[model samples]
Target chain A: MNFPTKVYINEVVLRDGLQLEKKLINVEEKEHLFKRLKSAGVQSFEFGSFVHPVRVPQMANSGELYSKIQQAAGDADLIALVPNLKGAERAAQLSVKNINYVFSVSETHNLQNVQKTTLESLEELHEISDLCIENKISLDVSLATSFGCPFEGEIPTDRIVSIVHQVTELNINTLTLADTTGMANPKRVFQLISLVRSEFPKQKLGLHFHNTRDMGLSNILAGMNAGVSHFDTALGGLGGCPFAPGATGNVCTEDVVHMLHSMDIQTNVDLKELLKASHLLEEIVGHQTPSYLLKAGPYDKKYPVPVST
Target chain B: MNFPTKVYINEVVLRDGLQLEKKLINVEEKEHLFKRLKSAGVQSFEFGSFVHPVRVPQMANSGELYSKIQQAAGDADLIALVPNLKGAERAAQLSVKNINYVFSVSETHNLQNVQKTTLESLEELHEISDLCIENKISLDVSLATSFGCPFEGEIPTDRIVSIVHQVTELNINTLTLADTTGMANPKRVFQLISLVRSEFPKQKLGLHFHNTRDMGLSNILAGMNAGVSHFDTALGGLGGCPFAPGATGNVCTEDVVHMLHSMDIQTNVDLKELLKASHLLEEIVGHQTPSYLLKAGPYDKKYPVPVST
Candidate 1:
């Protein structure tokens, strides 16, 4: 039950969160969110993605968003999602220092999602890796549906490990195993994480989980127990699962930080400030967000007794 | 990271779920729910609570509900909540085979919730234990706020241990540690469960948790890792934190069963049948319930693609 003293949280609200949103946030609002999240003590931020604008219109302002927050992103890691070589080229042109190229490990999910087979995506990733290296950008490979697929049920652990082997052999040091549809359980997460750590002892690992089945925090705890501390979380739990209809988004950043701090584990993020950011985002988005911390406050917060006015 | 081969889940939806619900389900509806839940393979059911009707109008028909479901409860454990000697006497008069006497561990919470100081509640519990013994009823003690308190945060381990000592001395073999406000983390849960297990090696333990802060399942995992298998869950995640306004209820019965089955941990409850019960409850309640499994379906369920209508 031992947990790491510190865990790294990369706020993905601007990227994954907005990508699935119905309304497209303008560059000004995105910049406001970026600065607010940065002030909340988040050291890592995923600002936008390089995917096609028509495909994900909410993230169409990535280029402008990157430029808007470039000055405020000093010392903090700024990341973007790049789906292929063209997306990587767009990110490199934007002078993005860190990028994650995501592809699904499940064959049917890969083909349905990105219109590419697993092997085809792998080949494209090789070219994308070359482009990243030439542009002097840090690239982390993200495997979507690495745990299980909405289209094709449970993915074998060996398949995930083999994909890790291929990516690591390409000299990519950082890899993220994403629970695309929130299909991961604690035992499965622990087993897969342990296997990945055993096979790639020097690889930097991150876990991205959706809260579709309410297994997000449990999976995070399992990752912590397995000695992996890096996680991707969205502010206000802003993302949605495209394949698993009615499923929720990524784990809420504020809730994750709150739990970690309550457990005496350091997240290096201010929970109070994070919750403020969530509130601000909710206002800008014109709807309520799915953040538990925003709704429930901290554990020690006391409710005011009812008074007759 | 080892999980038990089998876990015990005592569905408390009939009692805890309806107690806080605004719409009071009639006895016939409750009987139908009870039959459905039992058919779902739930071996233990907390059917009703013998509390004042003014305090909780929903559970006023504990006697009649028990009588209606008595014929269907064969070979399965039928449990009821008894807050004091009077409640225990009522339960005994109804010929209830199993009963739980609940009291808070925190002094302030005990007084505010039950109008009794911690010592006073313990005194009442002793009398209730005597009544149970005289009637040959199996008594389990439920300690609310065992982990944290809304009035007094972070209850000392020694205080909980002391309460356990008192209950164990009363010849109560089964005990439930309740996180009334969902203020539990995995490390704290494991530590507390470990301490209780060490002190009372022969004690049968169950954990009751609220999902206020969304740490319900994680705490369950911690308890499971500590070799505490029994749990108390409510259908549709019914039951709110009376103090923490807007906080959700106990962990959803179907979601818990879904995760357990996904993790290869046997709960002996059919997930499909459990979901059917949740749907039935939602129809009766006339609103969307909070069970994640109802919204997202199981991990293996696939969604149809969006079509141009």
Candidate 2:
């Protein structure tokens, strides 16, 4: 499974995984966990979000979390998700390494989840893009609900392309398509991702998928074939969409790392230690997470062959 | 996400999936389920394994099931999975359309599970290939545990090549690599599949995967990048290996089809009907199943967007 180049495994555990849980992980535990995950080979971490404190209390300490990550590892790249211009402003004030500003392209979803129309969100995107450029922070524009939407099923490809066109025009080359609901099918994933790729040929495309429909990894595969190299995953498949209430967790981090490493796509993540993180997260979330690798351990460690020493 | 090409979905509910359970599905229920699954847009079905009935009583009525499938449809392409010479002999004798012969290239797994060395399995595979050819039956060689083996942690690409080299010398041309333990990572899948494509060139390549390590769909994506078209799956992710007690179920057919269809990869499957088949399989098995789409419903069908009376 040796593929010459390495694919980045950006840990979204601190943000995506923690956002939905009721219990807040304080700054110290966040730092300790992030440091441990880094030791297991995660290069970049989407540590938290600067979304409104009223909506996401769990991320109330993200401002503090960002500062600590810088203290812990000077070279570590940190990303904080921002939903609007104000959120982006909060992220920028912290002087973070990376700011990921998300907006939905699907009108129905955009109106419902973010309380803004698609066009309005696009306006916000322009403002955020300019602010990030002026501040010299790496900005990743995430098109949320890029696949199918639970609110609006079967999002059109043209809609996605035009959004990419809008964002790409701002000279923002890095982008992500979030499968907010487990709504993406491989064909839709391939078609939409390809459209994004063809339009932004030089852009780095990343995927943030949910396993709601159990095709998270497959969707990633579809995106990868369409020339995507980056992906977003949460540890232990944590994070329920507060909007969708019952939707499952984000695609599991250790699970993603395990698959990538096995495929010989160098994730540099030690599966044994990632499993250790799953163990740690289980305690924080106060229940077992949905990740199977967390429960079963790595493929090689299973049943331990009966060889005598 | 639209790619305008028909993707084949082969149902393996009876073979790989049923082989894992404690209770055997009655012959009537299995036939009834297959009949409905056929109508649900599954064009191909790996009817059952032709192994010893004693080893898998769950498959004690495979001969009956095959005859029923033939009687049920005039042109349904029913393929049967055959593990060795005897399984092949029984499958060849049956009035089925195709015979699938499997050989794991991993020496440790081949030894642990089948008590045969890799060389010996290849010898048996050669004989099975000849038997299918002489009988004028179409054949598919499944390289089981291809991604990684349970007993042997990582399967090398060279070993896969050696097996392919030996099998290609025989009368068989169609091939599949099975992630039998869900141990395969996308990178490994891409590299091995790419290697096989470069080497085999003209032969058809298929993938049969499990979500054990939660990377099955991603592996399929990797396969697509390397030009694989065919896939093997069980309805409802229902199988597990009884011989190896803790193994997981096969990749769910409806889930795979839904993903493809959503991606605009044309799978003939009707999501609602397939979910019905999954529900029916649950009734026959006298228990619930692990399929997400079956319980959660399709992304399009869910939240049904109301109706004007």
Candidate 3:
């Protein structure tokens, strides 16, 4: 709990959020969200990813989006999600602050998601790390479906640790244990996080969870106990997986930041500003969101100070 | 994970659903939902709580409902929530299969919720345990707000454990780490359940989480990873705490059972039947529910047999 006191917020509205929307947001809207998120105090952002435009038309102008996001970040770090070394190379070439290398732990998910076995992906991660280093860009590793996989259920924590060990050889400074499919519970979360922290005390650990099954915030709190200070979130509880069955939304940014702030914890974000950013995202998406706190507001008790008649 | 072949399901729709409804649900409608849920293969149930009828008038027929539920549960384990020793004794006299004795872990919550300190409530639990033993009825202990308290932000895990230890003196066979106020995260949940299990391995650990801030199912998954098997859920995601600030519905039974069964993990329950039960409950409540799987049927990849061109 004390460790997560200084949470590093990674805004994923551009990449994870936009990727799920039916209407493709042009480069301008992507730039608008990133700038607004930055002004609202998001420390890091995943601007449009470097995937092929033909494959995902929503990200056709990723290169251009990255350039704009770098400017919008304004000294704050901006990271782009990269599927492979090729994406990493493109991201590294940009002025954007960092690159997050994404891979899946479950081989079934790895093959289906990124079209590579986890082992092959790990090897590629090493190569990607080399490329990021060569280009003088920072890199963080994200293990998708580390908790459970849509195709392969109940992923072993040992399997996740092995991947971490492999990534450690590449000397990546940080790793994220992502509940990519929303299959994590507190028990597995605590065990995995504690295992990772105990094994690699120096490596920074982050959490990426979805509220698909509605355990995103709880999992974050569990990560807090394990001393994790970094997390991934989307505004207005937007974002879901088209491939993963039963997936809902990513843990809402305003919800997580709201819960943390209320606990007297510092997330270095403005609550009202974050809410505004969420509302704007909701407007852009042409949909209402799943954030209850944004609609209801915080619970506060007050009194007309006992009449001293 | 191996031990999770079959998960215990406790249907809280009657008690939790009715407790939160603004309009009064007559006894006949309550019985209808109860019969439908039991018909859907729910092995256990919380028909209604033994709280004062004046406070929760919807629960006035708890005693009458207990007798009716007994006929329905048959071999199924039936239970009820009790706020104090009086409620426990009344539940015991009714000879319901089990009684869940609850007390908040936070002092402020204990007083605000029950007009007594946590210690006083614990003493009442001791008396209830004695009553259960004397009546040859089964009893479970619920440490409310074990994760975090609304009035007191963080209730230390050690304090939660201490309450578990005190309740164990009465030899209560089961303990539910309740996120009464939706303040628990997976990390805290994992650590707490792990501690309780390691301390009292034989004790049946249950988790009762709230989706108030939207992390209920993930918390359950976390709990499962930490060696928990029993859970309390409401049909159609009904129920929220009046005292517990920001508390929402319990983890939806249909959603959790759906995920576990789809993964080939056994819960010995039928998914379609549960959905039907959800529909029945929705009819009685006169509103739609929050359960996604209910609104949209279980995830399926099957497409209609190819038609001749």
- The DockQ leader among the candidates is 1
TM match of model 1 to true structure:
0.97
Model 3 residue B42 distance off true place after TM-score fit, in angstroms: 2.8
Question: How much RMSD separates candidate 3 from the native structure?
Answer: 6.1
Per-residue lDDT of A1-309 in model 3, one digit per residue for the tens?
233457888888777767778887877877787777888888877776787666667767888887666655677877778888888877766754588888888887776667788989988987888787777888888888888776677677778788888887777756888777677755467668888999988888889988765557767866777788788898888776555555667888988887777656788899888888888888788889888667645433211212224
Error of 1 at A123 (Å): 1.6
Clashing pairs in 1: none
What lDDT tens digits, residue by residue, belong to model 3 across residues B35-78? Answer: 77777788888788888887788788888877766776788877
Per-residue alpha-carbon lDDT of candidate 2 for residues B59-94, written as tens digits (9 for 90 to 100): 889898887778776576788887788888887777
Name the docking class for model 1: medium
The clash numbers for all candidates, in the given order, read 0, 11, 9
Q: Pick the candidate with the highest lDDT.
A: 1
Error of 2 at A169 (Å): 5.6
Alpha carbon deviation, residue B267, candidate 3 (Å): 2.9
lDDT by residue for model 2 over A1-309, one digit each (tens)? 123357777788898888888777788888888888877777888898887788888889999887777876657678888888898888888887688888887787676667889999899888888898899988888887787677677678788888888887886746888888777776667677777677778877888888888888777766666777788888898875666534677888887777666555777778888888778878767888988887666777645555524
lDDT of 1: 0.87
Identify the CAPRI category of the predicted complex in candidate 3. incorrect
User: Candidate 1 on A1-309: residue-level lDDT in tens?
Assistant: 879999999999998787777876899998988888999889998888888877778888899889888899889999988878889988888889998988999988776667788989999988988888898899888999887887778888888888888889887856999998889999999989998999899999999999889989999999999989999999998896444454568898988998899889998788888888998999889899878889788998765534325
Q: What ranges in model 1 sit over 4 Å off?
A: A241-247, A304-309, B241-247, B303-309
